[model samples]
Target: MALPIVAMTLSSCGRAPELRVNDAVVILSPVDSNPAALYFTIHGGPEKVYLNSVLSRSVIRSEVHESKVDPKTGMVTMEPTRKIEIPAKGTVEFKRGGKHVMLWGVNRPARQLKELEAEFIFSNGDRIIVDAEVRAATAGDADKKDAHSGH
Candidate 1:
């Protein structure tokens, strides 16, 4: 009599190797706009990740911006931030009313926003490059709400 072999496949839910992003979108601001913001959602990780900086040819300068609200004054302002942390096995969002990328001093008039590319520099020496699409400035609210809800 031949014995039947039993085989089992185990599924693993182990955390992803490192940090990553999803639903990444950049709303290209109109030409001549200064200090435009970029929003997106970052996912994945077994350890914490930080956003180091952002780079693009569309602007003269790039910086990380964090939005803070004054409880007493009921005012909001964006200021340069050191690093935005992404928790382990978790996610981080760059959204309006929160954190975002500030691109300043757009030099040329973006006709139809022909070339919009952004390089996301991560603290772990990882780079995620994304091409942003041209969108109307008025659509910021919709984009912000969608980003806040985790894209």
Candidate 2:
């Protein structure tokens, strides 16, 4: 009917929220060669998109990772992720106990600057560069440490 067509048209259209990254930060490890986690949020655009990669000129190694706790065992685990999907007009967050970027071997320059500049690449061919403030390790860092040490 006419009403159905109108609904379809409305559904097909969306107002992209400028497709940005915000509140980026890198939680630095006190020990050298230890891993760091990058957290941020991605505001969605006009269409569904995939976060392909998170790159850093400040660190030699980085990847998208997610943490999960087993319901039966109550054991937490971390795993590398390929791509993260962001729905249109929606938001995806990279936060502790959730999706985040794990980085290693942060060079002295980034530490001196107290920030890490990361590149967020998307499936829609949109790339966003964000400066994540570097901060000292906190209690939330224990999970990453446990996972790394196999403790």
Give the top-scoring candidate (lDDT).
2
Residues 31-149 of candidate 2: C-alpha lDDT, one tens digit per residue: 77688888899988878999999999888889898888889988778889899999988999988778988889888889888988899999989999999998878765764443443
Score every model by TM-score: 0.74, 0.82
Provide the lowest-lDDT 10-residue window in model 2. 142-151
At residue 86, what lDDT does model 2 achieve?
A: 94
**Clashes in candidate 2: how many?**
0
TM-score of 2: 0.82
Model 1 global lDDT (CA atoms, 0 to 1)? 0.66
- Best-fitting candidate, scored by TM-score: 2
How many clashes in each structure? 0, 0
Estimate the TM-score for candidate 1: 0.74
Runs of candidate 2 exceeding 4 Å displacement: 1-15, 139-151
